[model samples]
Target: MTRASRFRSLALAAVCLVLFSVLGYAVTGDRAPLDSFDVEGRNLEDWADDSRAFIDVLRVVEHLFATVGMTVLTVVLVLGLLLRRQRWAALLALVVMVATSLSTSALKVWLGRDRPEWQGTDFSPLSSYSFPSGHASSTAAYACLLVTLLVLFVRRASLRRLGIVLVVAWWLLVCLDRVLLGRHYPTDVIAGSLLGIGIFALGLALVDPRPRSTAAHAEPLPEVYASERRVAVILNPIKVEDVGQFRSVVSAMARESGWSEPTWQYTTVEDPGTGMAEKAAVSGADLVIVCGGDGTVREVCAELAGTGIPVGIIPAGTGNLLARNLDVPLYLRSAIDVALNGQDRAIDLVRVGGDGIEDTHFMVMAGMGFDAAIMEGVNEDIKKKIGWVAYVVSGLRSLMFPAIKVEIQVDDGEPTTHRARTVVVGNVGFLQAGMPLLPDATLDDGILDVVIIHPRQFLSWITVAMRVLRKSPIVDETLDRRTGSRVRIKASTDTPRQLDGDSVGEGRELWMECIHGRLLVRVPR
Candidate 1:
């Protein structure tokens, strides 16, 4: 995470804790507002305290899931991570668990407030400080950790959402149990939840630092290697820490392969890489190596499309969709090796125009509606912190984004209108999450694959998610699909749009056509 963003989250956490502390002081002084609410809540509970059955049930839930149950769940989660060979993740969980427990205890001791002495039938005897309910704090803490872990570790959308729902429900039930059992006031539970959240935000920075580690696989091999001689590399300086080191690596590899010292071009925020790529092709470069994210790669690929010069990719982005589809290694060393020694393969590129985007190209997919909303709404700070987990967070937030009515027309076919949450056009099947969004789509297929999702309800998304996960052949009205070389879509309104995860301004119409085997890219042997 960036220092400024980290500071903002930390400041928010600190503000919450300070607000809770002030409330604790005011409650001790029997001040207005908080004290008034607490006393009123106590009186209401006393007036409504008739059923021992519900209280007994709540007590049972508290006893089963509080201290011991929480500890057991933590152990099991950590053990599961360890079994999965995620030692870093397991260690992180352990640290956060211990930190949360100790911090909660310390806060409780510091506050040193007594439990409610109301006229209600209290199910359990509590002889400890109650300014912050330990049960509520611990439960919330567990929920935060487990959800974050799920967002980070779980790849399947269905399983991740299910796990999050179950975890959150378990904790919410625990909070209700504490409040209903008359062990804590509403203020105490609220404070506890805030404290848990604060600790979680803090732990994200302290326990596990930013820029988390990614697995490094062995260097990959390339197919037939032939160099007509000259090479040029378009580099994105912001994407790498030490640009000199990357350049040195490329130079050493290129020299080993009997190629001349490469012509280096740096991409700027204003001009990503297109102009440089064109210049390289015009200067008779046999190969153009792009060492940057998808945006840079897209620009270079689009610029050199029909020049017969192969483009080598060195992926440095979070969602390197094109590289992933091309079976290119992600590691810098391996990707450089492939760029220097790999064979060229012809692949299809989808050209998308209109809808505020003029004559742009997407080697992966073009999406509108819900998918575009996700790309447009993803939090920049969170994305820097947790990588793809940021997408999950954005996606969850955008699930309720209104659907759009779109008329899709394939080549020489009649237009069909549907209320769709998203309409995606793809040249490749697998998504960045490895979900086969268009199972039958292939880069060299010489056609475009389309999928339209129209979930009847929010829960119906599970059915769509399952279908994608299983690569089901079930194509019905809600999950309709079509394919053609040319596709024209007109939305009912000017909707958000994206070409390979990059947002194109809102537009009502999108015209796209596929160019088969139009570009050459390097891939693993």
Candidate 2:
């Protein structure tokens, strides 16, 4: 943590402590000043007691955030963190929650305040002290912890805002439930919230939950060269939130991995990555890290093909098909670690050409008709705001795209004619979320897998989706699959086309040939 951050955390904790101390002092002893406020706060409970329905709802809310409920939530949160390999975050969450709960119990016992006589008889009476509300404290701590994690791990600003809003709303409901159900006084909830917030702030100051630098845990690799290894990074500046911070992180990781300082190059509107990648290779870089979407990855990979320099991919795109297919981690730091320390695997690249577009290469898949229409119709502004959700919006709008007649020829076979809503040729089997659109496709198999979908009606798309998801081998007019080292698709008329999720305008034909073991990339060891 920076000095400013540490100072801010300490200041917040100190403020909470002072407020809690004053509140505690005022609420204790007979004839306390807060007694009147606490008594008046029961008016909400009096109103709630008139309606059994409202009382019952509050009771459910009470039980949902009670000690047992909170325990289950905490355990799930910690386990999820551990499963994601965020061990430090998991430990921090466990320690802060346990410590907060135990501290609340101790403070409640010390204060020894009695529950209000106005407490509802509809539910079992609490035998515990009432000065510090357990529900308020636990919920506060959970909300704080979750917000911290969201800020640390979630890259989308809109998503982080939504998560924070939901967490805050939940916390408010719990606090309101405490008062409405006559479980604790307003002052009691306030003190509990302050205590929880204070403890969490203290924990934040003491434990940085981010994963340690890759250098801290990785074993040194065997010396394979006598000279210092050179590394380079080609970044699309718009993809990351802070370019300077990203540069710092990559530079630090490169240093710790024993590589020389990376030669940095940012992609431009004129040249997304090809020029930068060629420059990096010409500079004698041993490793080149590319951080961008599938289109950018494709450009860099095409340039670096057969160069013997391993490419590290950091997936920072709406559709990171290449990285996902390669089993690369989406988490930025983890992807960096894999890039610095993982093994290299040779993968296939597809060379594609069409009528209206220049001959280019794609690392993942190429599509025509409906799929390309979806890509072409996507609203760039909306995509920038919500990431991949824009694709869903576009897909829904283009679901009933008219089918087009096409001829497909695999290898040296005679051309076969069919009507297809979409024709997709994949270098990798799965699309996003592991959807097996082409189940038999393998990255380095020296062949391309093709899927032709001709859902006649709007409802027929369901069957198409089911068949793809189930990896069904039954191929007919509704859905068909073919494979060959060289595949050519020719539409009867002009149709939309896409390469690696990028719209490449309307074209009547696309010819693709897979180059086996064409490029080297880093993957988890």
Candidate 3:
């Protein structure tokens, strides 16, 4: 979700709530027709009203699913989502519940509409402003949010439709109970229900406005020559100490699988893996396996883009962003098995270019400013010792980096100017520590997701962190996002930059283009 769309959704919901609250106050006053209709409906249902058993059941139901009860239920559900790493859905659910409850309270006090007078229906009395029914709004919000989640996740069409119907029916029953028990007028419940629906729609726009990918299955792989195909491995020697042992396992596995002897290219500190990958590809390798960190993979991928040979990954780095996106196993043996037997899937690769550097390709992400600082400042020895924890230390030291003014242009659109602490463009969703900076990003989507941060003060990092954790689309001056196939950025000063975690020095400008499905990757069948 972009910043503009998020702002517009919230504004529209606020307008709808205000309009409904005003309409309820203007029409549902003393001696109003809605009050007469409520009394007449009670009169028509005299037998059901006099049934002590039905009344007791409804009273118990209302007490159990009331505002307090629903709050508890929402907390439990949100906590579960967080624990499961479903942060976006949890934030949406939490926002809807809190906004619905708070709005109901504020509107009730503002309108000050009174409850229906129960003469002889055995309806218990309660004293409170009742312009909009709190029970009706709370239940309606839960129902609407549930329907949204069901539509997004439930695959069976019949099940989705049935779940929505059941939820709506339950909400209507709650509203009816509110009116029948003389706790609220019909118009009050109607307005409250509308408010709930409005909030729900807003939440959807904030968190899930983009249409989900609808492919039922991954693309089928082409035929592989099991008998004659040649396998080539680009191995980073420093990444593994037992090089002879690793080669023995590879050779044994290759022999057992009916493939020829594996061709090997050892990577050097000066030439990570790109030159070796080129050599292997030119030597007629059928499949090229990369065994190292993100930088090595990026180098190999850049060298082999559009060559039609599938690249397999053995994740031996701190942040295996591309491997995680491809669902490749992290263990060495499992990764080798996947590389040999897995299916090939086409994925997008990003081409980046800027001042003072040759064009390069990155399969994961590119960033400027604060993100680059975090990468550049990492202690190499610490990274080798403790893996990804080195990044945390660097990130903490770089939080107070100064924001810079930049002009950003998306595709053919006019350039938009802003001050930002960092700018990131990604082809995949998750980050090193599993934070989904771009929740809706897909590997083969043929576009890039851009996020910009501009927190005004160090204290505001808390707010920014919360928004990221929630995956909230709402943005003020502190955060914004955009998506496009081509992005051009020019900063006021030469800022630090990085591509797929490799430092690229400071540059004043960057131009990136998404190369759609330009590379093939091996993924588990």
Candidate 4:
């Protein structure tokens, strides 16, 4: 461990010591448990009867596993980080596990209070300690550790806020469980929680912080906008029925942000996200804000590939998956706000083709199965009737759609064949809410996520729907995953294609390859 790690560990240990010491001496006067000393406590039998359930559950877990749940949770987090190659994540997990264990063990042991024995229950084993619950300690410690890791690594500010909410919720649930299970008094659990948090924070203070990758430098001089910085707002006017309306909004937003009038581009179904982005580059726009839906973003992103012109999103089309995934504000105002002030995040884009032959780039995903078919079939008439829920009604309409034959060649992986409805390729997870459609999908690491869904029945459609809605990995006995820096997809027939949300006309045989990460995005800090 480095100096930071050592100090962090010691800090946690020190906080634990101080809190335990104060609680040991000031509160409850360090009383021993009734069972340990054979001391008679008022209402001892009642307390014993109430805590029976909690002890039983703990005993069950102990019987099945030698150690408590802390180690298992630690393993889970460690394995996740390990698989993801997130070294910092592993260290943070270790810190949380240690902090939780130490606080739980030391706090109660030092209290020297006797366990409550209401009935003929065996309080014989642990009678002396009572004030603090090991369960509460473990719960608080585990949850706090998890939250700490999220806070340290997760990029989106709103998501970090959500993680904070989730951690607090976990704490509440754990506290309630302990009280209802009669394991500890509400006050005891509360104290244990405080100790857990302190210990974790102390632990955190020790680990060396990763050098800020995009730390803000000196504040900029007060100016409406960087006059030197040129901007081009590329848009897919064809996305909405009225490009005129979307244009008015984009033009106004650009001027308000003190940016030069942007050169507008409308992508046609014939030539979606391609060429147009390159057009932005040629124009020398310092910043490129894409105002259409996911398809337009993908196109703009494709062209912005290699060029460091920071891209922004003004999501207008259906299924703003990338925008949702990036946590770009849904409302135009919030989107514009972030477009103007948000931290710029660099995300990977998959260029699915070799040097010239019919190549495509995607920011959300790329697949060739039922999902692809849905994207191809979705029409504006249906989309206008319903926003994203169109997937449900449209999906039902697409049940009769036949599967197409395709050959997939993953990097260094064997070619696999699948007869499916549509192959949906993804760069980010949420196909709809932009929730993480792929839990494993990270915007930074340069790799494409290929989801192969083999839904055999109507029930299968439900399963896919659930997968998209949940924004989690949908793995089953039948689901296959192919991950690589590049992928080549060849279809026997001209299958329907869509990038982002807009349809990318049909193609008979096409190849898809990943660009190995290279997209500049304008985001908030």
Candidate 5:
């Protein structure tokens, strides 16, 4: 952690400590000034008792955030972190919560504060001390941990803001529930919240939860050449939350991997990646790292196809299809490490051309009809806020898109006519969440896999989904599969089209040919 962040955390912990001490002293002494706050809390409880329904809701909230409930939530969160390979973060969460809860129990016993006279009898009788509310402290600690994780991991500003808002709302609801249900005084919750937050801040000051730098443990590989290795970065500026931080990370990792300082190129609105890639190649970069969506990756790969310069991909898009297929890590630092040190593999690229669009290449998939419509119909604003979930919303709306007649010709075979809702041609098999839409597809294979879906009724989609998920070999009119090196799809009318999850406008025809081992890309060894 940086010095400034450490100092800020120390300052916050100190402030919370001072406030908590003062409140504890005032509450334990005779006729203390803070006692009036508890009196006001009792008055609020009297008003709340008038509404049986509201009290009933608070009772449910109380049970949900009680000791047993919070323990379950904490265990789930820590296990999830461990499953995601966040060892340091999981350790930090476990340590901070356990330490805070134990400290709170000890303090309550030491203070020996009694429950309020107005404590409700509608629920179980209180045998525990009430000066420091356990519900308030546990919720505060969990909230702090969640906010820290969001800051460290979540990249999208809108999504981070939403997560923080929800966390804060949850904490506030727990605090309010304790006071309104006559379980604890307002001052008791205040002290409990401070105790929890203070311990968390102190813990953060001592522990950095980010994964350790790979350079610390990585072994040197045999030198490929005796000359200085040159690296170049082609970045899509808007794809990252902070450009400077991304640059710093890439530069640091490259240096550790024995590469010279990298030359940088930023993608522009007019030219997403083609021009930048050409510049990197002309400058004689040994390895060019491209950080953007699949479209940018496609452009760079196409430009550097036969030049023998391997491309490294740092996927920063909603659907990182190529990275997923290549088994590249999605965690930013892990992806960077793989880019700098992993082996290079030659992969096939699909050349595509259709009416109303220029000739182009796709490294992942191309689609026509309902799937394309979902991509086109996505709300840009909502997408900015929630990432890929916006696609789910759009997909639901376009699930019943009317089927259209299309002609499919694979390789030199005779054209076959069929009615379909969507036709997807994939250079790689899986979609997001490991959905095996094209189970037979392989990246280096000189063939394209096609799937034709014609779910006539709404319920038929369920069957199609089950078959896709199971990778069932059975093919029928509902879901037919095809494969060829060269495929031509001609729609009866103009239909929506997308390339690698990007909408490429409406067209009546899409022609694609798979080129064998056309490009070299970095992949895990």
Candidate 6:
């Protein structure tokens, strides 16, 4: 049968299983469950208990395999990326398998709310009150998943039959194991098995169960703990360097506020703090805070663009561009306290693209030409020694240099050509170390603040220098100060650009836009 046809069949089967589990639970949840068979037949309870010995071993395997539901699903997807083959059948099978198993678990918990007479410490391992056994459900799901895979992916009938035989045996044993161990009644095991079977059938309804490629193999990690609510922090210890102090303060504050001790994860430059933050999101972090300079904040911000988790920033870098804009306290104590007590505020992020493809999310501003030029020139050592003074030295050097000509367009608006020293696009106006770059830029505001500087004589250059140094807004008849949601600029000439203070590859044509009201921050109320 075609994979789609098979998937459709599997889906129907899964629906039947869910209906069976639900209707089955609603009718049988309060009854004796299986004692009627013992009363009608011979003394089979003892016999059934002994039958669980082999079933327990199979139970372990069933749990292990079932836990990898999502991993297996991903394997099916990534396999398609790596190889082109009849893989959808295999994908369909696993999908049904996982769906049924999850449904069965949910049903078990839902029914378990009402305690049955058979429930006690003897069945403690089979937790969540249990109307249908998760093990039995998993056994049924994986049995069907494996059989479907073999039938659809394997060319040889012998191999398919062998897989089918093994799966059916394990599935049966897993169910029998639960029954014999007294962990579940016969009805519970039977219901779970049926649900698994149904989900497997649903997969047949969705896609074919065939191994499309070697890449389809997935190794799921071991689950360490069980908690519905959790948080993970991936940061540079150097950024939060006084870990001893930071922890003590956060712990005390959290204790006072009724929050548990937060998990701390360190991220290296090699792995990038942003990637670690993404892992944190997948692992179920409710709120994430980053402690670093503009680059670290920007990197993590890129990953968290649409996650809706308010990112708390503890600025430790020399520039602290975003930190400055947000009015985040620079000292370690204030930063930590702000993270603990700050209210969540949403902000806009600017994206700049051009050249050999520089993709960056900027919280402070995007700069082209002189500002970008000076940014590239200043080294970390200079910044550490002289702080924002390094920018002054480089800015002066850049001011003396030739002007960069560029075409500036704003959100499908008219394109204007200009000769400038530098162009700045601000999301939240700020420069280095708590210095406000755009005085009127607000975090909650929905518009981007744009500034363009035109080159001039030495006297004019000095005026620009004084204007920037004295923190002038720099709006004039010639300079561009426009507000728009989307801004497009093409390099009339090749120019260097810096985003959120980090220098990216130069680009001539670029589209910069605000991902409006998307950032969530933990700021004080």
The predicted structure with the larger lDDT, 1 or 3, is 3
Give lDDT: candidate 6, residue 403: 77
lDDT score at residue 189, model 6, on the 0-100 scale = 67
Q: What is the overall TM-score of model 5 with all chains considered together?
A: 0.91
Candidates by TM-score, descending order: 5, 2, 1, 3, 6, 4
Candidate 6 residue-pair clash tally: 27
Candidate 1's clash total is 0
Model 4 scores what on Cα lDDT?
0.63
- Give the TM-score comparing model 3 with the true structure, all chains together: 0.58
Tens-place lDDT per residue, model 4, 1-525, is 457767766777687757755655645764434233232232433454556686576455433332345577678878877664456557766776676676566656766655544323453344446567666666666676667666654433455677788877866765654444344555566667766666666656665333222213324325445545667766666544456765676667567656677677777778765777788788777787777767667767877878877888877766677777776755555576567555677787776643223666667765554555676666766565545657766666777566677777777788777766666566675555333446676677776677666667767767765765665454653355667766677777777665565555676544555555487786645
In candidate 5, stretches whose alpha carbon ends up further than 4 angstroms from where it belongs are 2-11, 14-22, 29-33, 214-216, 412-415
Model 4 misplacement above 4 A: 1-227, 237-279, 354-357, 403-406, 434-436, 463-477, 490-495, 505-510
Better of 3 and 5 by lDDT: 5
lDDT of each: 0.80, 0.90, 0.81, 0.63, 0.90, 0.64
TM-score of each: 0.60, 0.87, 0.58, 0.51, 0.91, 0.53
What ranges in model 1 sit over 4 Å off?
1-228
- The predicted structure with the larger TM-score, 2 or 4, is 2
lDDT of 1 by residue, 409-454 (tens): 9999999989999999988899876889999999998999999999
lDDT string, candidate 6, 1-525, tens digits: 565676678667867667775646454545555557523212333454455555456456545554475356446644652353334644564465557656876776666633233432333554455566677776676566666555533333344576688879867866665555455656666667777677666556545343322211223223355444344555666544366776676566555544466777776868557777888788777667787777888878778878976687877776776776666655454565566556667788777677777566777788788778988888767665545668888877776556777777877789888877778888876555334446567766777777887747767765664675566755773355777888876776678888877787577766777777877876644
State the lDDT of candidate 3 residue by residue for 1-525, as single tens digits: 667867877787788677675658565545454555556645534545767788787788779888789989899978976764456778888998999999899878877766666523565477788767888888888897787667654433455677889989988898877766667666777788888877876886777522322121335345654436799999987776478988987777667655589999999988999899899989999889898889999999889989999898988777889998887866566577777767888999999999988988888989899999999999998877656779999999999999999999999999999999999999999886568888778999999999989999999888888888899989667989999999998999999999999899999998999999999988888
Clashes of 5: 0
| Clash counts for all predictions | 0, 0, 0, 49, 0, 27
Give the clashing pairs for model 2: none
lDDT: worst 10-residue window of model 6: 212-221
